[model samples]
Target: MHIPARPRQAPIVAGGLPADELAERLRQRLDLPTWPLPLHLLPPGTALVGGAVRDGLLGRLALQPDLDLVVPTGAIHLCRRLATSLGGSCVVLDRTHDIARLVLRGWTIDLARQDGAGLEDDLRRRDYTANAIALPLGGPARLVDPTGGLDDLRTARLVAVSEANLQADPLRLLRGVRLSWELGLELEVTSGEWIRRHAASLVQVAGERVLTELEKLAAVPEGHGGLIWSLEQGLLSGWGADPSASGRLRSFTPEQATACGLAPLERAWALPLARLAALLPAEALARLHSSRQLQLRSDRLRRWWERLEGRPDLEHLPESRRLELQQELEADLPALLLPLLPAAARGYLTRWRRQDDPLFHPMPPLNGDQLQRELGLAPGRQLGDLLHHLTRERAFGRIPEADPAGRAVAIDTARAWLGRRRD
Candidate 1:
């Protein structure tokens, strides 16, 4: 077993704070009761680095910040042990990179083996200086500023460790831009220049990665500004988006989200997807190399919003049609329908808001077996259609959820529906 080094002296606390004071400051910044995690039995050479360190140093940790640790080895076993000890779950995030993840409560801990013999080598390979800083787990809490990350963090500047560091992974290209917006930091002069120089290089990256970054950007309260910045900086263009629509998308300020009246979770998915739909051309979406599933969901969202924009009045439609549309629209993720939720759809929106209401709710006590047995309906396409129709009617309180007389009433309804079908 590797032994942790004894407590050692560190460089003069960058901000002139003494060791104990700095430790306390870092702890408070991260909302932690202690500087480093008090992992008494952990193997040596484990250090906390990346965004956890950055946020703590900047005094900007979220309500619960994730932990990022770099270790000499045993990344998998260590993460598993951590998960077991903490009553969390462990998964290998990337086998090739020897990266494992341990999820505990609301916090995630990512552990990766050191890329080289020393922590400095790992820091040098990191994307930004703000993320390269480290705090050893073994010794007295001493800030590790291998790439001058401490200085950059204090200055609120985003400085890339090196061009090759970013060039090696084009995802870092968008990551740089995303980070600037997330942290409210101004990019360092040269770093900003490098981002622009390599914006188009992102096409070489995968669409899922690009979309993931966009999703993250959209989740932020300032994400609208971030999205505008991404477009203005040619990052979206690199991903084959139509940059001119940034102005159109930028118009969707946080105020408009408030107007949409979607809960926060709903807003996160809908607003971003809506902006992307508005900005990217029909063909542009296909060009991003997104997975088919993502494309399908996106297209469905676009269709719903388009329909809402063209005709939002669902009250006039037949009850069956309205319920059909409701099921199509709500689908558990009402946030995806935010763009389509024009004021005209307020009636349906009001109904949805009353989640406890059995009528017009997404989940209701309606199923196929009851109709088949009660109505003596055979299993076939006709029975299936009847059940779907009855489900909607039942969901809307137009029909009883359960039939006492062996579904005699449902039998009449099915006969009437079939008669209408024939007519």
Candidate 2:
């Protein structure tokens, strides 16, 4: 494919910022003054590129953003040499592609050999215009945008570098959607069409890579919309994800989670869990090679949700059934609350937060050891049944459990119950 002509001598100010100012800003955010891998260590043709550069332009660079540099050659060797001399660690990410990562202090710097003739050729090979942009290191702060990335950034558009690039790495198809929503950019029309055309090929990519992208996409503030768009475009259909579940994502919003008493950290994991469960069933997650813990959470949430939906209210369920619900969802109650009405969700969350709430956080008033020691009870199925009974009694306030007097009352109640069973 013939590449479009890009400016060789760009304007002093592109993307509404002067090159020098942008460079200074990146240096400040990157903390170049205290960098362990000195600029002198890098070869002449190295350039800082990818997300770091893109995020710097948007003034959203993280405190410790990973730095990506395209070197002229021997990227792996350079990384190893730097690691050995600087007393850091070197991880060979891709030996075939000559990509390696240098870990020093708390910073991660990925060094990859330039793909083609020079920076321009390499930039042209990138997946999206925004990521194709680069800034030369150890030189004047000049923006090398072979794909008109600066203009696309200015217009808040996500344009694919080329259809071929998207085809080269099918993961880029999913990445485009994530980047667009994460950065508040719109996917350009032709680029969106290209993504849809190659969506099926995404299944060929590594499951771990696909899972990583999905996790990041699901963590976005309004990520559900992005997931829905991916489904609508058939990006996730090749996998076991049901497009029909997209509506479930639509209804699960950040506001609903907050109303359910999910703090930032709680929402971070809960929202993604709920959203992922909505789109992919346990079997689908297993096929994706997701963690066993994640699969279990998804399966449990889905099963209980289905069961609870059939009942009028979680509170109105039979005592045994309600106790089971509380015990099963003890850790992930907030996630289950996402689809419920705000008031009801708030009530459940409020009770769940109280560590001493017997029903919400069920605990047996008397263990088998305690029963045997205090009441001289034998250990067997009878003991297990007694423990279960005590847990249910405490959960429903039938057995008091807060103080010394409550403990005495609980033991007496247990003795009486055991005597009744004997009779």
Candidate 3:
């Protein structure tokens, strides 16, 4: 296992921008592994464009530094070199058009060549004027704002380059609102009008892509505001969400989000699914058919829907039945349902309101082996059935918590059920 000695390279130092404070600050903001002069990093004639430039101008702090660069030619291989130079990874996102990405130190540099003849022509085909921005490199680099993106950036307004251009991708209508939410920009009157006009075209786009974009807007608590706007403007109607779902989500303001529940939603793994289930009514949510994308099982959703039915007066239910709901909250509570948890169904919501660590519910103290050991059984379907029965009984509060001795009651109940099964 002889390995070749590694070579050490020079420290990365980025080239200077015009002696402007803002420009230098943006250069430093680049998520580069090291600040080596980028003059010799990529091939000649590469330029920075799109969100990295837009966000830099707006002085927004980038959590995950991403820079979109367009080259004159041979971008895929060039990006591979750039990725290696930074001791990172590269992936060819699109082979036909030669789009590639270099991922380094939480920074993603997407490299592609100018799609059309020149950069200005390329900028013309972009969706929004605020995103149709560029900054040329390796020369007298200056801000190129052909679509008046600099002006839009200055005023904190979003403007589509053209109606036809925006219509090319109806997703842009939603993305406009996302950028608005992201950078705190207001969608321009004309751009908002254009979204309302062509929002229906989103149906023609791919569902998976729509889901992808929705995930971006749902990744953070602030994203709820964008989702609400999209639903209000009919931007999400094309994706099969009920337009009325907007009003429901609009009520989930920062205050309500904090009050009702937040830890589960804010740090959700399937954020889009959490957002959808939190915003939509029980019946409206069933229509999404999103289990595959959300990685949620169909039967679990059915059980959730069933619970909403007979949304009875929990205050008036029999003592045992009220306790059943409380224990049910401890068994497999999905994060999405946290916001809609009524004040009465279970005290689990109360725990969340008080900022508890286990926001949804707590795990049981036992496992299959423990149950089997307690009942004097080996591995088999009958043992599993008994274990599941005991677990369900525990969920219903037939077995008291706060006492390991109480588990024997559940074990006895399971053995009696097995005796009946034998008969």
- Give all candidates' CA lDDT scores: 0.68, 0.84, 0.62
Model 3 reaches what TM-score against the true structure? 0.75
Off by over 4 Å in 2: 1-15, 310-313
- Please list the Cα RMSD from the true structure of every candidate, rounded to 1 decimal place: 7.1, 5.4, 8.1
State the TM-score for model 1.
0.73
| Residue 348 lDDT in candidate 2 | 82
Better of 2 and 3 by lDDT: 2
Per-residue lDDT, model 2, residue 120, is 98
How far out, in Å, is residue 9 in model 2? 28
lDDT of 1 by residue, 210-296 (tens): 777776766555666877777887877755666666655664555666665666655556566666665565566677665565566
**lDDT for each residue of candidate 2 in 1-423, tens digit (9 for 90 to 100):** 011111222222244666568666656655666766799989998999999788777665666678899999999999999999999999999999999999999899999999999899999999999999888887776678889988888888999999999999999999999988887889999999999998999999888888888888888878899999998988988788976787678877888898766887788888888888888888888888999988988888888877766443476679988898888889988888888777788888888889999999998886778889998878898888888888898999988776786788789888888999989
Candidate achieving higher lDDT, 1 or 2: 2
Pairs that clash in candidate 3? 12-35, 12-36, 13-35, 13-36, 13-37, 14-35, 14-36, 14-37
The candidate with the higher TM-score, 1 or 2, is 2
lDDT of 3: 0.62
Arrange candidates, best lDDT first.
2, 1, 3
